[model samples]
Target: MFYERFTFRLIFKLLFINALGWLLIYLILKTKLWFTIAGLSFILITSVYTLYSYINQIRSDIKRFILAIKTRDHTLNFKNKSTKGSFPDLYNSFDDIIKTHKDIQLEQDAMFQLIRTILQQVPVGVIVVKDVKDDAEQMEIAFFNEAAATLLNVPAYKYWHRLKQHLPVFTAEIAHIRKGGKRFLELKIQDKLIQLSTEVIPLNLYGADYTIISFQNIKDEIEQKEIEAWNRLIGVISHEILNSITPISSLSDTVNSMVANKEYLNKEDLEDLKPALQTIKRRSEGLLGFVKDYRLIAELPTPELEFHSIGGILQHIHVLMQPFAAAKNIRLQVGQTSSKITVNVDLKLVEQALINLVTNSIYSLEDTENPLIEIDYRLEQNKLFIDVADNGKGIEPEVLEKIFVPFFTTRKNGSGIGLTITRNIMKMHYGSLEVSSVPGEKTIFSLVFNYV
Candidate 1:
């Protein structure tokens, strides 16, 4: 519609000027007069100037409209009193387009603000790292929330590349995450334990990869678990002590009554009294041993942390369990994914933990044909893991839950304090003991060590 109206106006102006030119030529030729020539000259010059000015005005108006839109000048009004016919319609269309763009811009800004507010209010820390467009190896911190700044002890405005100077381990871990490495990590930063997770979302914001990392401080959760575990331990200890003490108390009372009635007792009664006395002695000794084990759990020594070879630890464990593995006909093997991998741990303490795990694996393999116990170590995302996996009668789900509780045992004549002590040793070295099992299939126990 706008084009048709513009064409009609152009054609009308051209035809009107052509007719005027024809009339001027006719008068100049027919009259053959000098005065007519001067008059026609003046009229033609005036007509040409008017035509040029009109065309220039239209061109200028169109240019102004485009400039206003390009500069996002919403205050410019295109409605003009001099602009008649279809020109006004063209001007109004331009104004409508500018208004629509402004409305969309406002909506987008509001949505962006809302998203930013939500991210800041979330409990978990959020960090967005974007690769630098100019430097392929460099990365910048595009956005980070208050929680992220506080948890990382970094200014929200600082770029990630600058963190290498003060927080090398953290920076390296983030790089590892961005490279599609490990997805989850539990790290000790300063004195706080943080559980960090990452999600890589490919963003074409500037033709570069970006990663979003979320982390939370899990120290409180761990402390709560420790409290619950202690409560369960207390209950188990109480039950075990009562079981041993109740029998001793009744046997002692029987012996006392038999000795007190010496005049009424026969030879057979004397033999029965002797057996009751021996039973009491055995129960007393058992109670004493139980107390000793409980003391051991309470007095676990602090680890003397140092770098230790993973291969050496596994070799020592393999030798220690050689006899037991042979007796059970279990194939015990030790392997590592890398020979250079090492762990910062207390050699004696970690060795003890590994031995306890291997022994448990050995015991589980009893009565199973062609049982296998594999001890393997691997390094991942700046962390080390020593895994003891066994193909045997796996642990029951109910029993697995209480395996870490002190004195909670599923085995006959088992002390049940071994796993408890092993876990404590791991904790001392700034590591953790994790276990997973499938009944009648397999069991895997992982010793996670933070290498940093």
Candidate 2:
């Protein structure tokens, strides 16, 4: 209230002083009696105006300072060069303060930008959560590259899935792996299996923890292990073949020399020699058959391709096996014949495979009463399916896994290259041969082929 009244009184005094001073100057110039009084009054009024203008300038500078502080820019200086009195020192001090504040702010901004650049190029998926406990935790996902997306099987645009929905089971598995100190955990989703590696590190601020997860595909590694196993088995089989054949050939030569020399002269010796010679002959024949089967495993034939109707091919197999089925008191039937189902296959190789399958079925039916073999073909969805089903004593689970393996057999005189050769031939034709069996019920062998 006093400031307002002072301003009003100052304005009134200035107006009245100006009017009275002008009147005095005019009268003094006219007469020269009160010239000194008018000069003194003019000087007093000029001093008051100068003081008022200086105070108002100071007020305006203070308001500008406050506005700069509200905008968080402390680098604005107050410049009042016209005031060369005691207030010059105050204005210079405020300018120095502004310079100091500007330096501090610049250093802070530089440090923030440096940290941002480091996080942006960290080469890992870095997620920063500002508040760990609250639900409104601000999350920033950064530094996910193309390789990371491919490894994780996540699309580039859609890197984040709700943790529970995409891999609920696998997330639990990953947690278990983390607790156990395992480097990675493999999990299957659809047709793809990914290995996830997780790590927990302390956040730089507020003593919180953040988790980082990395993903990789281990399917190629699994395939490499399987190939190594197969190669090792092949090496062992080759060594065994060498060991068996070297001694057999030496013994056969020794027996031939003795028979040529006719070393036994007594009647008892001759009688014993006859049975011995017959035993040797039978053993040699069996050993020779074994060698042939082993060679067949080592030297598989390349498929010779030909195009033929699948129905006619199965019909030919049925006719070829009529005698064997009849001998075993088994009925052979073929059905579901499609007229135009054709496949590019090695006819000779496929025929041999079919013969092997049918022969195995017949052999399995020795003790079965009223056994029957069915050979059929069908064209469904542009693929040819040939099925060979038999009602016989089915194979055990343990034996089924080894059925396609070379020199693995359950039969008394089985050479065991039959199924191995069959599977190889089907693979050469770019088809697949699958077998399913129950313990005492039917056994099925399905040959699947896609039309070319």
Name the candidate that leads on lDDT. Answer: 1
What number of clashing residue pairs does each candidate have, in the order they appear? 0, 0
How displaced is residue 236 in candidate 1, in Å? Answer: 0.4
In the range 81-154, model 2's lDDT, one tens digit per residue, is: 42453356566766776677778778999997897677555544333322234442233333344554455455
TM-score, every prediction: 0.60, 0.47
Off by over 4 Å in 2: 1-265, 378-383
lDDT of 1 by residue, 1-452 (tens): 66787688778777777877887888777877778778777877787787788778878877886887788777776666226545667777877887887888789989999988999998778878787768844678778899877877777855776766666777677666564433456667787767665444445655667777777666677679879977897798789889888998899888887779466878898789887888888888988999999999999988788876787788888888878898878899888633666677888888889889998888888888889999998777757889999998999988888898888887788999999999989878767899999988899999988764
Q: Rate the local accuracy (lDDT) of all candidates.
A: 0.80, 0.69
Candidate 2 clash total?
0
Inter-residue clash pairs, candidate 1? none
Residue 164 lDDT, candidate 2, scale 0-100: 31
